[model samples]
Target: MIGDPKTGTLQHARIEGVGHEGLSCSAVDGRPLEFALLDPTTGEIVEHGPHVAQEAFNVARQVYRNVMKGQGWLRVLSEPAPLTARKAA
Candidate 1:
């Protein structure tokens, strides 16, 4: 489970892939998780993941939580920036 920094909301997600460069995931709610995906190599949250079944996301989140505990890193999620329209300067 990841917590949204903006609203303090939590969501479930599954780690689809992990590597030094970055990590990929899918959300369990059939709607993308609002937290940034973490890059283990840099130890930073950088991107978001796709949507998946709620049940799957929940299970994946639990597994992720356990893995995180072993890594000795804070289990917090970063919020992604909101997109906005740009005006010609």
Candidate 2:
């Protein structure tokens, strides 16, 4: 599950490998899983696989990570802070 932090909108997803079909409401599990992009708010399916493919899922996951980094939500805590003149004194 992933969400738009700014909008509070959520997306539900399921990924299961081949032969796991119908286990978790998955219709087909060929490439990886029965992949479905669903809008939780409207209970609608935005997209589904065998058409959506694993690459699409990888892109989506990377996009979410990029968004978090852009919003300063994934900052690295180990980095040193900038030194000011007052601190130098």
Candidate 3:
């Protein structure tokens, strides 16, 4: 619900499987603990806890986007081109 409202509109990582095993916690504390979401394809992982799931998911999504962009799999139209300063006349 929080974070980028357009997050749903953006392209998300193709996660083959997510490991929620890390969510379990000891009976002593009885508090929900952070857990990891594992993306089987690019190995992109993120840890989320309690009410912060949306934020963590967004972060992991960005990481995946960056990896794809770096690998030339996707291009950002808003990416700024290199700048070159002009010589003084």
Candidate 4:
């Protein structure tokens, strides 16, 4: 999930879903985006910022295994499951 952190209104990383089987995620520079969507025509963001961007990290990590195996397109889980709860003892 590591990519260019600064992408204007919505800062995020781009995953190519290529290369080696090994993949890792890390927070590069800058901070999490406060807003998820923006209006190009009006140049004004939505009143209530959607937290989808922030939730992406949690979702990705929760399905890291499927991603690494290139099974990201598959429906591995019906809903996002916290990695902490699935952590190995």
Candidate 5:
């Protein structure tokens, strides 16, 4: 369980699932993930492993973190923001 599965935010990644064939889970992310969600609208990260296998959670953690940082989170948090749209008529 990642992101807000119940809220369907997990779909944004198009991840569908992670891990091996027997142990896969949905990947989750959203603007709230970048600090926009309050307790009511946000879900905490859920770990599905004790990492019986080496480099399991560690690798996943790195990957997930990178995704968030590389995505709009970096721009969204910057001062004045950087996502305003240029409208055309």
Candidate 6:
């Protein structure tokens, strides 16, 4: 999960819902793609949008962490290696 800190969280725009058969609804919180970040293995969207689901925030944190470490955009499904390597025995 090597990626830049900026935007590493894979933040997403608000998801507004349609109400009353065409009325406007408030935008959902927590972004949409964040949910996928919870599970690094599958990286599936446990739920449709990140806000409704709790996983999005988790992914966002990962993105932020990696980006801070001078990494590039990384997918939740991707593997995250250690920042430093140890000498081989």
Q: Which structure is stronger by TM-score: 3 or 4?
A: 4
Residues 1-89, model 4: lDDT tens digits: 48866533423543222233323232345433343445878877643233444344545555776767887654444454578876853
- Candidate 6 lDDT by residue in tens digits, 34-83: 22223567776444443333344455566767877878866554333455
Tell me which residue pairs clash in candidate 3.
none
Q: Please list the Cα RMSD from the true structure of every candidate, rounded to 1 decimal place.
A: 14.0, 16.5, 15.5, 10.6, 15.1, 13.9
Candidate 1 Cα outliers beyond 4 Å, as residue runs: 1-52, 71-89
lDDT of each: 0.48, 0.49, 0.43, 0.46, 0.37, 0.43
- Comparing 2 and 5 by TM-score, which wins? 2
Report the lDDT of model 5 for residue 8.
Answer: 45
Candidate 1 displacement at residue 41 in angstroms: 40
Local lDDT at 27 for model 1:
73
Question: Whose lDDT is greatest here?
Answer: 2
lDDT of 3 by residue, 11-30 (tens): 42222224442123222344
User: Which structure is stronger by lDDT: 1 or 4?
Assistant: 1
TM-score of each: 0.22, 0.28, 0.25, 0.28, 0.22, 0.28
Q: Give the TM-score (vs. native) of candidate 3.
A: 0.25
Error of 4 at 25 (Å): 17
The total number of steric clashes, by the backbone 3 Å criterion, in model 6 comes to 12
Q: Model 1 clash pairs?
A: 28-54, 37-47
| Model 4 ranges off by over 4 Å | 1-33, 47-53, 59-64, 72-89
**Deviating ranges (above 4 Å) for candidate 3:** 1-51, 71-89
Evaluation by TM-score, superior candidate among 4 and 5: 4
